[model samples]
Target chain A: MVWKIQGVEGENYLESIKNFLNQLLKSKNVDAVLVPKRFPDGNNTAQVLITDPGKLDDIDPLAPVQMVNSAQIVKELTKDPVKEKIASVLRPCEVRATIELIKLKQILDARLYIIGYDCPGVYNVKDYIEKLEKSNGIGKEGFTLSYVNSFLSGKQDTIRESCQLCTHFTGNSADINIAWVGSNSSDVFIEVNSEKGQSLIEGLAGEKIGDLIERNQKINKILDERKKRQENEIDDFLGFMQRCIRCYNCREVCPLCYCKECLLKPEKMGYSSDRYLRRATKKGQIKMPVDTVLYHLTKINHMAFSCVSCGLCEQACPMDIPLGRIYNVFGRKAQALFDYEPGRSLDDELPVATFKEDELKEIEDVKE
Target chain B: MGKNSVDFEPKIIAFLCNWCAYAGADLAGTSRTQYPSNIRIIKLMCTGALDPTYVIKVLLEGADGVLIGGCHPGDCHYINGNYKARRRVAILKSSLETAGLESERVWLRWISASEGVYFAETVKEMVEHIKKLGPNPLKMEWAI
Candidate 1:
């Protein structure tokens, strides 16, 4: 069911979201709320856990910048059971990554309420800061609203590439989704996607709205453009990966890469001066930062089946490699072969972790 | 290292599951079912334990091809190990394609203990395929 949340006549749409979250806190619907808030310096936004209703003033869930996939934050918060209920407001990508982490046994989701929203893709941190600086007097909220408008109108192209190609922009997996795809500026649609969402908003009064035909249409249009873009970029992996310096920033930011001791680490890779010299001797010429290609290949082997394509890895790359696009291409193919969609639901088993007797029969059929 | 010359012999690294493929290879040796001398076999406890990194390491270390031999479906001594191995190999092959590597260089097949002749023929076919494919482009001269 869809319900409308009223906005102050001329106030920003983000204000309406803040009002809803503030209600959740003030009315004791939830003990606390986890959402992104702008720093006092007006240069950054990060997730903050707020218990006080008054602290909702600076909450900007729609800010067009994501420093990290908040799914990791959710994992940190719920790794152990908490006495008080926490409502985590996350972007769709983060929500999906959180679901994957839950399946990987990194999170205990017993008392957590996942709140997701329509993600209008975000810009890279450096690019976002530059845009913020250029919009001199406009506050972060104002600048973000205008940026989102331009993006929805197809005039903005500065979003990270993974987001550009993302077909799953809506938070269908969240319990409660703050839907704005087809809704007007004066009000936002609150969708109760699951039983938890239904129970959470039981007493809140709002106008009931039916199926959003316009939203579905808009989503299809975006998907077509993204599929075309993906086809154009898929084969350029070798060129993009050539400049990697083996920094492992991509691995560090990935929410699904939840290994306690990563295989890519120096100790795990068994790196030594003698090993490097020997590799150099054998190769005749070796790149200074060795195993750049191997590091990526190993990562794909490990987690491509679970990759949510949030693109945090792309944002974290120092070499500007499109690691997100590369992983997504491989992930899409691998997941398709097994007819699996990671993060679609908790019930779907990871492809690598399970198998069927009659499945993948072609692997045994040797064509002479 | 004139890899393109007719005298060049492709080096193939084969990881055989001990329960089925390794026994089959041994049977081939004892039965004198002659196969090419290009393959160097490593016996693994189970194909499910085969890490994609080993396949990658050998290729990067100058092996022209990788051959993974496991038990037939439902014939694995450890229940469904071969099934899991098949899935891993599939994912690894797709990843290799994405990395601009020749995925065809990696082959997966089932070789039962009783099928020693099939095992010899499979090796012969793999060696010929690798010879035609030439040396792995990522192969380096020094040991990895």
Candidate 2:
């Protein structure tokens, strides 16, 4: 229940991860190592993939921006039946989303070694790179640990809207919890939240440990403020989303989105000429790219029950739509109605997939 | 038969495939055989080319019932068009029924180039049934 830490610079975090994997590789303890890789385009961008331990040293884990949710990548990789055990380094969001994917049968495994990290915040890759490009102090000189620490101290707006409202900033269920925030120092807090996490902690023979109680409390406080900010941001975000051209980028990037055929495609479901004419007559102007509300509703009704709130959908939007908040709204409702949290645990049943006679009766009764 | 009992006459929309069923209908005409006048044939290339949505749309838009006629089993001019059509109807029927629509509103029948007698009888049987049952409730609702 207690979170723990060891002080190291952000630059050292990646190097330490490489070192940890290198040690595991030497021992031949795991089959593959999953890490973040830098994009070739000179942007402060990174993506997640399962790579061999030999490639661990080149991983850009400390890269200041996020483009895609690592959880989705992990879900794709883990979906196939595999015999080899792989160790995946996940941010808190990734771990949470991955849990939901596991429940949906989108990702399958007993062979995954999840190493969860405490996140300070991450910027949208494009926005972050643009800001970094304009700033004089930080350029291609490479972001050092001190620079990140300074940025954190100033409370600059580096985080995405999804990240600001992220309540689950600390991963609750991972084989190993690599803590960063909530403590007085920048040291990594390593605590085992589960039996496997404890085993991983015990496996680290020479690493120093520190108290994580104050750190967890600080994390909780930040989460509280972030939740309130998230609601306001969602209102502002939806105003921007009304401009969406109906591109499916948000759906494509979403990790927990496992539908084989999306209901939004015009072929499956689109406004007929009759519906179009009706809308035109009623509203005086026909909404182009029609059924926008229905598209979101159908998707939310179908999948919100298992939404992991990974926020990759927002990142993938070309329109810069705050799809994360829209998803979170429905997802929060589905979770509350069923008293089921997606990705919180592997054994939990997915709400949409599982049918119960008495479930959602209150809502059903209201309808009746 | 009881005095109050009306004989069941099935309402049928025979969608004749241009190659087979339509040819059969034409043959029925040329042969000078007396057949039911109730059938209204809509010519199509192959039974497999049917879209279930189109079928549902028409059914909901006032078609009392539908009868999709295709080439018998392996006799389809477009290889497996009939086979595929069969599968689509099977899925559509169950889905529509689940959505509270009557599955009987849609019907699939495979009649080859030689099944004129069968086609005529099928149409007669359908008209008699529909006349007794009245118009489809769904069609009435959509109209309103």
Candidate 3:
């Protein structure tokens, strides 16, 4: 059933969401709530896990900036067996990443009520800060509302490239999707996609309405615009690799890069200085911080199938590599080879781990 | 062909599974089967143990080609190692293509331990094919 959430006493959509979550806390439906909130400075937002209902006053459910994928934090919260339930409000990509983590065994069996929202794309933290400065103290929540207005009308100017290309913005894979794309101004549509979501909202928030809201038409329209833009910007990854200094920031920020013992470590890369010099001697020259291409290729090989195309890697790059596009394009291709979509469900087989004894015949034989 | 092109003897790194291709290559030596001398062999317990990183390393390090030889289907010494190797090889090739490298330079062949003659012919064929593709472009590019 669809739940229509309207702010009590004429509050806006952002404020309305805060009220709903606070209701959940007050009613004792969940032990803790994980949502993005404005820092005490009132200019920026980051995710926080709150236990007190009073602390839910400044929550921002779908702000226009994301500093992390949030799945990494979800993993930390759930890795050890937990009895208390967590209601995590996440973006579409974070939902997908969380599912991948579950399949990767990063998240153990933890009770989580995943609340996803229709993300209107996010700005890179740097771009968001620059826009905030020009907003003239409209405040973080106020600045975020302005962006949502443009997004609803299909006039979003500058979001991260990965968000622009994202087809899964609604996060249907999530338990619950908070929708607002087609709604009039401050009304929120609570869409329950799974049984778990239905149970979480059993006796909470707004009267149960039989009428459902459809985000498909608007979502498809934005995806069409994004697909067209993607065709025009097929930039060369090699050009970006030349500028990569091997800081491994892309790997560091990736939610799927959960390996505790990374093969990319210098010791596991296992290159002695003597071997390094010898390789240079043989090649006549070698790039410093060696294995630049090797590291990237190996990383993509390792985790491309599980990649959620979140663009955190691109945001993390100091040299401004278009790693978001590079990884998404390549990851989609890798996934296509096996006809596997990461995080679609818990039952789908991982591309590398399990294989049919009879499938993938073409990959075996080399052409003459 | 230009004199330099004709003189180009492509360097090939062949990863051979010990129970099959490694033994097959050894059999070819004892059987006096003639193949190109360009191949440098590395043996592993199984093709599944051959991490794709090793293939990327040699290709980036300027080897002209890579050949991974294992038991034919339903014949892996480890039952499913060859099947897993096929998937890794596919992923590795996809990675190479995405990086703008020539993926055709890498080959995966199913050769049994008893097929000494078949193993020799596969090497000769790989060497000739790589000769036409020329040296790996990564050989001269210092930026990696």
Candidate 4:
């Protein structure tokens, strides 16, 4: 059953969500709440753990700005079992990455209540800060609700490229999904997807809403447009990779690149001075800080299946390389070979971690 | 197959599993089976141990081609190393191809210990293919 939280008088979309989170905290159900709050820098936003109901005032979990994927944050929170229950409010992509992390055994035993929302795509941090300054006089919530309404109406185009093509913006894997797309940013809807989500909304002030036909149609429209625009148009990989200085910032920002002992590290790659000189001599010449392409290829081989296509890698690249689009193209193709969608479910096996005895025979000994 | 790139000799890195492919190469050597002197063989305990990083390293470091030989399906000495290798190679090749590189430069072939003639023929076929493709494009370029 879908429940609708009617907006209180004079409350915008952001205020409605804040009030909802405040009630959930006072429900005596969850122990602590993790949410994205504006940093002291007055520009960036990051996840903040709140234990008191009073601390929910300055929070804007529905803000259209994501500097980092919260999957890494969730993994850190649940690394050791929580003392009690903790509720994490996250975006759709963060929820996807969280599910993948749980499957990869990165998250330990803990009571994690996942609160996901229909993400109205995010801006690169720079753009978000600039937008904040442009609307500086208005309060944060006032600016955010207008932003959400605009995004829901399909007027903005400055969202990150990955967000434009994201088919999972509806929080498909979360236990509880907060939807605002078809509600016109006025009536916030809470969708309980699991048993834990039911408890979070227990005895709350809301009416049981019926079929979400309008909401479903709007979501389907977005999905259709993104699907049509999902083709890989990269023509020359060599030319595209010309500006890489081999800094590996893409790997550092990727949520799925969770290996503690990465083989791509310079020490692990074993590129001694002698080996570099010999390789340059052997090839008549070689890239000085070599293996930029190799690093990408190996990373793709290792974590492409787990990639959520969140575009944090592209945001992190100092060279402004479009690493997000490249991974999205290749990662989806790799997953499609086995008919696997990473982070879709906890039951589905990772393609790289498991294999069938009699399957994928065509790949071996074949020229193709 | 005498079609040639004249003086251009392609460098091939052959990661041959010891139980099957390496033994097959040894058998080819003892049986007077002649193959092109293009491949530099590195023996591994199993194809499962063959990380894609090595293949990528040699390719980026300017090896013309890579040939990973292992046991056929249901014939793996470690029970299923070849199967895993097959999947890994499939992913690696797709990643390479999507990035606009020639996935054909890397080949995954099954060569059993008893298939000594097959091993020599596979090497001959690979050498010919590489010769036709000429030197690896990454060979002359210094900025990878």
Candidate 5:
């Protein structure tokens, strides 16, 4: 919208988020704003539930800059069946994860409201600070918004290989999509992607944004450049990932990884305490992480139709494995098979759990 | 056909409920009805006892086809096991195809205690179709 509203009373992105939380708390309808807080050691990211408006002042939405798919947390909250509507600010992957969870009936819809923003990118908290220090000689403790924004704007050194290729740079399916891709002179592209989004737009009572044809075209060009860059990075990632050390941080950080008893569980996987021993034995002698490929394949079998490509897995890797691109490549194939896009529609059934008679005729013919 | 070619023999596993499907197969045997011997039966207390993994693992282990024959929807000995089994198997079949496995490898059918001929004929048909496909590629070396 062409609203002349300052993001904060006087501050920038940080102040704007703080003000938004303040407004949310004073509003009678909102009960909570589920959020993430900067940890004490500040080495990793942790999710938190924020009820008090005072805590909003210290909240750092952009700190750590690590991506998380928060679908699981939102899905868990929705099942409470509360009368009070809850609001959550989420990453794009989190929104997509919630959509799949809603479709699976694991979560309820009416109880939650979502706010999403265009993702500049996220870092593996520790890796981000380390890289910032190494690249610019800025100490790890000195990293800030100006540092991150300069890097994201590409005025600084390039972003991680995975971030460059991310296709969903803009939020497409959120209730209220926040945009900051335009120049300081041009107005922000505040697009309402749904009925709830439109309501939030009305509630703001901001000046209506004129159709941003030229601005949108410019954004699309940037996105196209990002896509091409992502494709090359994805290729590099897939090849590099063959050297994985099998840390499960990627699975842990992923918002959509909500399997309570995933196949990797000891009871299900048969890989007991000897997991590392087996890997050591198989290292170059045979491919270690015996079912690394199978583990991914099984997950894809179950959840590819629901994958949001949040890329937290790649960010969370200690070994710098690009799990997100590996997933997105297969996810793209699986999504295309059903002609369905994750997070695009809540009413659509996950492709794995639903079938049509005409869908696999090629397999039938191949059988003959 | 090559001179050394062997006649196609399908390997099929049948999970028959004790109440109806088992009786139906028994009836077929008593009547001397000719049906495919490719089927090896596993009797379950109820068709609902059949695990979804059993259907998938058997296919992965080289069974050309699998059949779960239970009591008609309401006629389960355990009240509603067959219905639950139906829902899970239907979901599993779709999921298998999505994973690049063929869905036809898993099939679900209902057989009453009186439907001896139907059980026999269903097996015969499944065996014939699977014989044409030979073996599951997931079990074959060609599968990536």
Candidate 6:
């Protein structure tokens, strides 16, 4: 089912979303809400858990900055069962990552409402802060609304590289998808993608619009551009990876890299001083930070199949390696070979965890 | 150490699943089957238990090639272990390609315990392939 949450009078899309979230809080449909909101300083937005309706004043779900993938937040919130149902307003990448996390048993599905929105993509945190600084107290809502407008108008080019290349910007997997793409300024399109969404907005009033041709066209155009960029950017992977200092920030922020005891940890890597000296001796001279390539290779081997291409890892990288693109390229190939979509549905088994007996027969055929 | 490509004597690390490949290797030895002596075998409980890290480590340590020997499909003692191994190898190879490494340096083959001749032939074939591919760049190299 589809519904429209009418935009508030004399307010922009962001304000209307805040008003909708306020109503959601007041209606008691969910016991709590998790949405992005400006911090007290009002310069950045981060995901916040709100229980009081009045606190919705600072809500800014459409902010062009993402400090972290909120799937990690969902994992933390639902790792243990909660009695109260919590509605999480996420970007498409976050929702997909959350779904992948759910499959990995990192996040519990019960007592959680996954609410996602049409992602206009986001800027790297540093880039966002720079843009915020330049806007100079235009206020969070004002700045973000303009940023999103310019991005939608195709005048903005500061979106993170991963986001620009993202094809899965629609929150099709969410229970409730709050769509603004191709919708008029005065209303938001609420798509009930699942039964949970259907029951949640049971009495919400709005004209049920038919399938959006303009939105589909826009999505296709963006995807084509992204695919072209992805193709163009494929050559610089090795050169970019050469600069890695091996801080492991990429692993730290990766939503799919959910390991209780990560094998890539220095201790688990079984690195000894003697071993390092031996390696250095064997090579005559080894780089101070060894296993940089091996680290990436091992990580890709572990989670490439489950990768959601959220780009949080790339954002966290100080070395500026295009890890998001690299992982996505590798992930897409591996997932394609198995015909697996990481977060397409809960029913789709992870490629690594399950196997068909006759699958990958070419790998079985011994080359003589 | 200064040997030319013709007499390079490639160092091939073979991870053999205990249920089939390892037993198959043992059979080849007992049956006096002749094959290249270049392969160094590490017996694993199952190929599914083989981590990609082990393969990466050996390759980086300068092994000319990696040969993964799993049980034939449906013949794994752990049921679907070999099937899982196949999937992993596929993923590993794709990742290697993305890293701009030679993925062909790794080979996955199935050998049943009864197929001693096949085991010997596989070792000979893997050694020849590795010889043609030359030494792994990571082998005794300071840079990747």
C-alpha lDDT values of all predictions: 0.84, 0.62, 0.84, 0.83, 0.64, 0.83
Number of backbone clashes in candidate 2: 12
lDDT of 5 at A296: 48
Q: Compose the digit string of candidate 1's lDDT tens values, residues B35-128.
A: 9999999999899999998898787677888999999888999998999999999899878877777788889999999989999999988887
lDDT of 3 by residue, A81-161 (tens): 788989899998999899898888898745888888888899999998888889986767788888888887787668898
DockQ for the candidates, in order: 0.50, 0.02, 0.63, 0.63, 0.09, 0.65
Per-residue lDDT of candidate 5, residues A159-223 (tens digit): 55445566666666777665655535323445667776555444443555566565477568767
Give the better candidate number (2 or 5) by DockQ. Answer: 5
How far off is residue A104 in model 2, in Å? Answer: 0.9
Worst 10 residues of 6 chain A by lDDT: A1-10
Model 4 per-residue lDDT tens digits across residues A170-234: 77577788777787546578888877788888877778888688889998988888898787656
Candidate 1 vs candidate 6, DockQ winner: 6
Q: For candidate 5, what is the TM-score?
A: 0.68
Q: Provide the interface RMSD of candidate 6 in angstroms, 1 decimal place.
A: 2.2
How many angstroms is residue A140 displaced in model 3 relative to the true structure, after the best TM-score fit?
2.8
| All candidates: TM-score | 0.94, 0.63, 0.94, 0.93, 0.68, 0.96
**Which candidate, 2 or 6, has the higher DockQ?**
6
Q: Is candidate 3 or candidate 4 better by lDDT?
A: 3
Question: In terms of DockQ, which candidate is strongest?
Answer: 6
Write down the RMSD of candidate 3 (Cα, Å): 2.2
**Fraction of native contacts, model 3:** 0.63
Error of 1 at A198 (Å): 2.1
Per-residue lDDT value at B125 in model 4: 91
> What are the clashing pairs of model 4?
none
Inter-residue clash pairs, candidate 3: none
What lDDT tens digits, residue by residue, belong to model 1 across residues A54-93?
8988888888899999999998899777799889999999
Q: Against the true structure, whose TM-score is highest?
A: 6
Query: Residues A1-368, candidate 6, lDDT per residue (tens digit)?
Result: 56766443227777677777777777778889999989988988889999998988878888888888899999999978879989999999899899998988889989889998888888999988888889986776788888878867875467887898788988889998887787655467788899888766655555676787777787787778787776422575556767988898998888888898999888998889999998888878888677887888888899888888889988999987888788888888888888988888888988878898767776665454
TM-score of 3: 0.94
> Residue A353 deviation, candidate 3, in Å?
1.0
lDDT of candidate 4 at residue A178, scale 0 to 100: 78
